[model samples]
Target: MSEAISYIWLGVLAVFEAPALFSLAGIGIPAPLVMLLCGLLTGIAVGATPGLAGPMAMAVSLPILISVFGVSADALLPVFAFLIGIMKGATVGGAVPAILFNTPGTPDAFMTTLDGHPMTLRGTPERALKIAHFSSVSGDTVSDIVLFVCAPFLAVMVESVLDLPEKTALIILSLSFIAAVMGASVAKGLISVSLGMVSAYVATGQGFHPRLTMGVEALSDGFPLIAAVLGVLILGEVFKSIFDMWRGIRRKRAEDHNADLAPDGLRPGDIRRILPHIGRSSLIGCMVGALPGVGSTLAATLGHSLGKRRHETRKGPTDKSFGEGIPEGIAATEAANSAVSGANLIPVLSLGIPGNAAAVFLILAADSIGGFNPGPSVFNFAAPEINPELVVAFGIFTLMALGNLLNWTIGGIFMRSMGVMARVPNRILLPVVLLVTLTAIYVQETSLAALWVAIGFGVLGFFFRVLEISVLPFVIAFILAGSLENTARQAFSASGGDPFFLFRSPVACGMLAAAVILVVLLARKK
Candidate 1:
């Protein structure tokens, strides 16, 4: 109880102190720099092991999270919040490399290449990256502020009157939103979600887990989140590319002889050009990020589409047209993608529901060590044990600010240096990545089985990428399936299996209505 109270106080302090910290930095040291250092240390340590990714870090830290902070629910809030904030900032900071060197430092920054590459071609790569970084940071910061302000109110309403049935309905509603907003086709997205649910059920129930096992018995506990992510996002991609090369589907390009091809820094005019679309893109990103399944790529696409639509609808000849190499497209995409970083945390932090694969891993990590559960009850139940809010706020603020600082100070240098990494033979890098993944998984559970599971997922992930199916849905659904099932079962048991009992509460009814509406709208779109 004392620990929980201390956590809550810490959360309050972090919340109030974030803005002050921002102000103090007023062009002194960049926030992104600090975030980069922290994240770099964290990532290197986590990434060095094959099976330990961001989620695993969180999981491994759970013992410390619970013991050091105490097991109260609220105590975990601040830590989770801080993680979210850091993720938000880091997601944006990653684009610096993606824009400058065509090497996406993070998975979420992939889409930045579309416009970012073009700017690099125009000899303004630094300017483009800077703009992207600024827009992303701006969007994320704004969205976090929004989440901080709104989540409590939403939680209040959810906690005060929501019964079991109402809660179940809300979960369904959230799921529907996820399916509808994600992927090009709602059917495909829903199918992906269904696949994830089935996989989770099979893994948990049948005991033949989807991504666990390395053909060894020791890893039977199941695959660690870290291993799965590294395989899917990093190692898998590298292997796939190598395979393609082997098949002659891809060939090495001749080294660029022209030194002039290198990117020049951004111009002052570039910043001014992107300013107009900042607000719109940020809003789009925040909304999309708050929903599950819809990730940074979609957020970027949506922001671009909205910007184009707005630009087209304007009557007179405007100085800024969106499509023809205009900075607004870059701005909108950057802001939207960045905004997702923070907003994605809303569900993960407030409820145990993970909106994306990364959050799903985080949830797994939290669950592994008997820490806080994800849900509305987390705030109330854990409040006395751990202050999740404070941890979340502090971590986020630190990471976001640090990430941005890193972007401003060394982002360009990093991008320039990344060319060396890209030049490194894939043969060496792939094996290294694989080795790291294997080692990480082995340490997590002392099991070789987990390593095999990661390999299996890597192959599956490669196939999914080739097939053009949305992997996000499957990942999100898999994470949420257990909670959804448990909650529904509880609600049903409480209501004596009477379906109508779920509709008795106004909140439940409203959520159901919304779900229906969402389905109808999606059907119409189809």
Candidate 2:
């Protein structure tokens, strides 16, 4: 216990003295602190704007950060600190659009739109925003604390029990779960997963020459993952919004929509009233987020649904129901989604598997910057020389704490201000977002080929959206396929290419069976 407490104190000291330890790019300033501040401000601003999100911000900043920091062991902490700030900031920021304009900047905020916009229509936008801020920060803070406490233990356990075949089977199970539950139709989800697997296979020289590049020299490097993600998710949304605006669909009204409400700060009584809802929704988010392949959208949906059920069961059918300008609705959705931001890191930290889009970006950043990798190795301890990845993880937690503080102090103000900004013409907002997105992609890749790839994926994504196909499965599959292939190949190679190796291990067999059962259950549910 003393040793653990000592390590905790050491981590705290390291966070405060980070500037002294990391000297980045010959800059005298404390890079982590400055980057954290920049990330928070940028995340909030971009998240408030429709069609922009935290992953987009991370994608844009990643290459710029790598270019500036020069990809060394020292650069890891500063770079990851910025990402943590953005991850926390964007969750709080997304509520601004959802509450004021019924526009969810990210998929996780979709549930917020149901009740949030109604509150805005009721002229209580401030109150709705406050509920969102309080619940979001509270859930995010608690989830981060859970992550800090649980990740190392889980990683240790996995390392002790899981071998190569079991790990490979686990990955397969995760892929199955994602395909089963992510999309509207199982057939569509399978098709999307196939597309991702095919895309990932392109230019991948896994005991075979690169295929699918069409003999183009630019394709030799394989598709840029960050560019592809930004194009499909961010630029695609920008393109859709532009087309919608041009067609006079989903356009903002020209008249100002700000409401003149009294000071809408939450009182102690109000906090006490909503604390139970926040706790319940946060627990839901944490559990879902901890499961690999399940995501924030589902968490938010489930949280809102459960909260609504609870409200109806408790009320005498006379109280104002959920989604009827009630604070509980905002609390449920915001808390769940915000909690997901932190708990999503659990899988990434323990298993080296990214659970969501934002986590994929984090893994990419860690890969791009050398000297760090996620997984059980990150939690390994060596005497005298601290585990660098573990130290960086602690630093990330510190930055997250700072971001939560920022949200608690000023997030409500940002949310309140969104009433005015939400009225900005999509014509102007979307085009700028598009230009900035493309420009960022260009700067990062430094090639016209990358631009073309982004444009291609953007068009594909637009059509997918139009067809009501979910992109989550596709994105998750794309990110997971490379690791999946590598792990499977490694497992096979270790077993002398024995095809039945997976069935030999009880753990692997059980996991595969569970996956099969889960798929059947989900398909039946659908």
Among these predictions, the greatest TM-score belongs to 2
> Which portions of model 1 show Cα errors greater than 4 Å?
1-9, 12-36, 40-90, 101-111, 203-243, 248-266, 309-326, 381-431, 497-500
Report the C-alpha lDDT of model 1 over 217-247, residue by residue, as the tens digit. Answer: 5444444555554455545565676677678
Q: How accurate is candidate 1 locally (lDDT)?
A: 0.59
Model 2 residue runs over 4 Å out of place are: 1-10, 20-29, 206-208, 251-264, 316-318, 382-384
lDDT of 2: 0.79
Best candidate, lDDT: 2
Considering summed lDDT, which 10 consecutive residues are worst modelled in model 1?
251-260
CA lDDT of each candidate?
A: 0.59, 0.79
Clashing pairs in 2: none
**RMSD list, candidates in order:** 7.0, 3.5
Structural similarity to truth (TM-score) of each candidate: 0.73, 0.90
State the lDDT at 479 in candidate 1: 66
